[model samples]
Target: MSDLATCLNGDLLCTEDATRLEEEEDDDEDDRFVFLMSRSAASDSEEYIRFLFSRERSFGDFGHAGGGDSLMRARSAAVRWILQARIRLRFSLQCAYVSVTYLDRFLLRRTIDSNQPWIMDLLSLACLSLAAKMEEIKVPPLPQFPAKNNYHGKSVLRMELLVLNTLEWRMSQATPFVFLGFFAYKLAGELASKELLRRAVDFIFAAIEGTNLVDFRPSAVAAAAIFAASGSPPTEKSMNQGMPIIESPELDQILSCYEIMIQAGASPGVGVKRKRLHLSNGSDL
Candidate 1:
């Protein structure tokens, strides 16, 4: 609803409008997901944070050094699709974030051959569908997700299981958004205004969409986003508690991420959102 979202087509695209942006999805063949036992909803526990930061730090440079731009391009395209679904189907941005996490983890483990674009599209849809199921109650049937290729419900379910096994059922993970509030108040306290948080969300989303902040931990990105948004990092003096968010040893990492966040302000993955909304009413930024 702001100038940035309207101008950049951020996370504000309406459901009806988003549908108009793509072809109507085909009906999935009547196929039930096997071993699709109901799982616990996503929680921000220690394990979640561990899964996001601990497991992998070797995903590559997101470039052709792995081979070519094909993988990177596919990854970027999948993010766009997830964003569009988040806007259209009214899923929380957190769900989109989780979906992207699934996509990235899966891609890292099994690099999709450049020749198989359909695999990318299918996997993207499955990942988004699984995320919506995790983060929202009114998730549509698997066939409902718009995609370039018409995927069977069974196929999507298979991909979901593959993703699940590969991720070790890490349906929950910490994200940059989780620490935005903590850092804002830690740094600005009573003076923390909505503007500071808004700017930080914009910055975090932009960095996630590009290759700017992927290698850093979520806390680092959150601290860096606040630093980038409000003009400085949280100092030891600013901390009202035991440890500063960015310790002296970790200060270098935060600054590096902050520099990238500033450069990636206008990055393609920009998704400016005003509401700290939930998954149900949709549009979490």
Candidate 2:
């Protein structure tokens, strides 16, 4: 093994005192996170939509997988930090996704210091902090992160700055959440229930645990999540009904992503669980 990979094969998976963060919020927080996007989408021309997908394509060319298993575990560990924060803080899943988007983009461009596993913990916390500032209705203070002896304020600030600079200060990430509503409506109509959207969100959070989803564009991942949530393959007519609903050229890609999510998210004697996610289509559910 390379020095980088060898340094990572230790017990840095998680800290023991994970659930100590005490945060409380009301049911009303969900209202603030409704999908404010236009379902008609008349405002977005085809060119603009294509531009969004193209940008995702450009952003997803992760060319830094030289470290094999240890590196993959490191990445997964960092994302789990975000998940732990989300569960403890009861923040919007959008916040979690934004954190992950920044983490993925940052890791794509910057190398983690192999000797400093705690740096992954700090980076994960910093990414979550940045995303909460962006998406949470009430951002929590960094003190809520259950910091160890080493996580000082200045260190976190430095790490946050490093993440911003690494991503060139561009934070308008096009995550799969951006396309969940549009793709679900386009492909499934009313069949895409409140229950279905909930499952899709679970699939997304579960599927994004590691690099299994690295190659997919956000839209493709969104479509695949919809399929995985439906708990069955899309019908031939449903899949072929229109312009961008998993067109023939991209059907295989969506299918491949679907299998990945099922494998990545499956549990024994149980299906995917629902998270606190809801997608509104400017109409009644």
Candidate 3:
């Protein structure tokens, strides 16, 4: 097995080996930062925006197969489980966002048997595990994952393989979080605080619960969240007052997405019942 696979399976490491792993992780972070910067630059291009819009349309037709309501319920449950795992594992919000992207994309292509709700939980666990491995310096052993679904470590590993195959190994997904920093910088300039960024991220997470918002591009969604959290209307004067004037297609898209968020009950101060799946094992999905 690869060293990463061995570590994920709970193998013991010597002190020197651990130190070496830490150094490797630091290098990986540097590489990741470079890649993210490149992606952020590309995302501003018309070609990249078109690609994201096309991909959104492809995935938007999901949740209509094999009992629509059941599928949505399952998806909602998986999202909740992912959220809980993020908290318990102390994972970054970016990790959770990428995992949710994987889960949604997988469900878009693969149909789950709704009668077997455990399948959804297994998928959620696999996605979360993959996200942790991608975004975290040190991931917990597979066996250490939440055991509510009675899923064995082997099951999670198998499901992880399936998810990887289903996603065509496109693990580094472009989520709203990827564009968040850029948008926040554009909106708040040097005045952006950790609290403001956190609130915007929370708004994005809440909006993710809205099925209608799934069709929006991640960039547009990120832009809308920042706009809403800033408490500024998307007017010509307001948007261009002290900031770079967002014009034409980009501005229109963000405003449109914000409107959708409002209609879907993702507006600030709006409370919508997030869908949940209640299975026999007291495990979500």
Tens digits of per-residue lDDT for model 1, 10-90: 231223421233422211100000001001112233455445444332333122124357778877777877777676666
Off by over 4 Å in 2: 1-51, 58-66, 148-150, 234-238, 242-249, 266-285
Measured with C-alpha atoms, the lDDT of residue 189 in candidate 2 is 63
Which whole-number lDDT from 0 to 100 does residue 76 have in model 1? 78
List clash counts for every candidate, in order.
0, 0, 0
Candidate no. 2 TM-score: 0.74
Clashing residue pairs for model 1: none
Better of 1 and 3 by TM-score: 1
Q: What TM-score, to 2 decimals, does candidate 1 have?
A: 0.69
TM-score of every model versus the real structure: 0.69, 0.74, 0.65
Task: Please say which candidate is ahead in lDDT: 1 or 2.
Answer: 2
* lDDT: the better of candidates 2 and 3: 2
C-alpha positional error of residue 35 in candidate 3 after TM-score superposition, expressed in Å: 20
The residue-level lDDT of candidate 2 at 173 comes to 69
Q: How would you order the candidates by lDDT, starting with the best?
A: 2, 3, 1
List the lowest-lDDT window of 10 residues for candidate 1: 29-38
